[model samples]
Target: MNVYSPNLELARMVLDSQPFSMYLGARLTAFGDGGATLELDIRDELRQQNGFVHGGVLSYAADNALTFAAGTVVGPAVLTAGYSIDYLRPARGEVLRAHAQVVRPGRTRVVCRCDLFTVDSEGNQTLCAVAQGTIAVAETALPEPVE
Candidate 1:
């Protein structure tokens, strides 16, 4: 089942190119043939009025993780076509981890699902959100935005 080999260094470099992800301190903790995990330390600035991790943050994690998972199977050039997420609980913890896996892999598109979890000081994880996304393969990397 391990048909694809993952390049952690390449993945890290790709993530580092993303300013938003770098600003959030999100790191690629794990990457494999058809799975990836992104994690970020929780900060007060990332919290909402309810003192829970903001939904936007969770969404970003899910989106990136899902796309990265698909990238494992479909190469590096890919974009998220669309995705849906469901919040299961308010997230409050020391770290947020998003784990994603490819459900189906094809030449042009890949389906991925992600589970967002909150990890407490004791290292217990609580699932707070779930997401599913479709990734579209690209022939080449997208052009950088004009500043």
Candidate 2:
């Protein structure tokens, strides 16, 4: 089912206002009715001592993707209820890409799933992690923070 987006531009603005996503260099590449895709570059700053991308970084990407996917159907005020991720392989690549989709959308909650991949310079993608999460529509619109 397709629903009208209250304000698509507002979604982008909200994402840009996220301090953590900005700090991590995450970019919202695509947004649609019930899905979203995001990308992040793999830089030395994002790597752990073991030289692999940090688990937290992957989790962050997954979490954001899930929320964004839900937001497509629930509106930009959606919040992540909870999420779980499984690391399938060590991440090593030039960039990271996350694809998220809403499995179910409800009046107040949405179930989402996301797949995180490592993309090489050649454009080959390797699945590194998977996530499942629930997103909830906020009770009310929150005011923007004072900077």
Model 1 steric clash pairs:
none
* RMSD value for candidate 1: 2.5
The regions of model 2 sitting more than 4 angstroms off are 1-3, 6-9, 145-147
lDDT of 2 by residue, 21-131 (tens): 889889888888789988999999999999999999999999999999988887776788999999999998999999999999988889999999999999999999999
Candidate 1: residue 80 Cα off by (Å): 0.6
- Candidate of highest TM-score: 1
For model 1, residues 1-147, the per-residue Cα lDDT tens digits are: 425567888888888889899899999999887999999999999999999999999999999999999988867888999999999999999999999999999888999999999999999999999999999999787775443
The lDDT of each candidate is: 0.93, 0.89
